[model samples]
Target: MSEGLEESHQLFGRVAEEYDAARPRYPEALYVALEEQSGMRLAGARVVDVGAGTGISTRGLLDRGARVAAVDRSDRMLSRLRARTACGALLADGNDLPFRDGAADLVTYAQSWHWLDPALSVAEAVRVTGPEGAVAAWWNTVDAGKADWLAAYQVRLAESCSGYVGPALPGWSMPPIAGVMAAAGLAVRETWIGWTRSVRLDDFLTDLRSRSYVARLNGHEVEELVNRERAEIGRVFADGRLTVPMRVYLATGRKSRPGGG
Candidate 1:
């Protein structure tokens, strides 16, 4: 990871509790989509969840009967994940997994792929999974275009947060997932699933504060931003409840069997 990216990971570790509480969980539809796209059943599948922060995705996988191993470079984040889930937590990076070849049925990155170098991480994921195994990477992002209030929030974020860039915040752009996976000899497919969540205004604000971009700000700056957001969002959500529009971007890359089927 680059210096800035490494620093952001450490910041996430420092606020692991807040992140676990505030970050949104992936919708169940996402897992169904993963199963359909990867042609892999979740029941009893061995999964390596790379960048498994706070066990959000890891827990989802476990609920579906997958035996998952949560891997992350942040010890604090892993500690929180371990406390919350039954999965084994490993302190490791995505580019270099400790597992032997074909050890896992699937390798997944949940909202954490951006932190990895795709060229190296993609290769590692392919190497770690068995024949016909798959690799999946996904992110849950705000669909600002779906709601006027969300659009305005994005504008405010761009104006106030130095790290903000469109809806992908923190990261300036989406990764070239298809190209990298194709280069690694995997068949890749992309899926976008739209979902919504209703949250209290305070909880929504807390989620914003937990974002790497906002969390990296100094205390005064973060407080100022949160205060402004409270007033602005309060005007829109008089009942103190917010309906957050979200979209899940998922890319599944499946390995071919020996016969290339």
Candidate 2:
């Protein structure tokens, strides 16, 4: 990985606890769409969740009856994951998994794929997944530009954090998923699931702090950004709470055979 990306990957460890608490969970509809798009049921599946973070995606897969092996590069993040579930945990990078050939029924990256080198990670995903097995990558992207307050907050984030490249505001456009999956010789189906969460002002502020880009800032910068954002949020949500909508985009594909099936 490049130095910037490596640094970015390690940044989440600083706030793993806050991230686990504030990050949004994938909705049931997303799981349903994954099943439909990948032709793989979560029940009785052996899933390897790459870059599982603090087990947000791992716990969700486990709850749906899939035996999940959670893998991430951050030990602190994995520690938080282990605290929540007894599922197998490995400190590994998405580009280099420890699993053997065809050992996994499904491989998933939830809100973690952006941190990886897509081509290498997808290749590793194919190497570990069984023939015709499903590889699913999804992200919970905030619809930040939908509201004026949120849009202004994004501006503040960009100004405060130099590395604040986003999930594409306004429409929340997804990354180039089809191209990367195709490079891995997989046929992909894309699906989108929309959901909303109502959070108090404090929790919402914490969510901002948990962002990888925001977490990379110095402590003083984070404090100043949060204070400014809090004032803007107060103006937007008079009752000190508001509903934040998110769109979960799932790109699920099947691993191709060696001879090009």
In order, what lDDT does every prediction score?
0.88, 0.83
lDDT of 1 by residue, 9-121 (tens): 69788778888888899999999999998889999999999999899999999999999999998888888888879978999888899999999999999988878887999
Task: Evaluate model 2: give its TM-score.
Answer: 0.92
Top candidate on lDDT is 1
Where model 2 places Cα greater than 4 Å from the true spot, the runs are: 1-6, 167-172, 256-261
- Output the number of the TM-score-best candidate: 1
**TM-score, per-candidate, Cα-based:** 0.95, 0.92
Model 1, residue 228: what's the lDDT? Answer: 94
Q: Residue 130's C-alpha lDDT in candidate 2?
A: 87
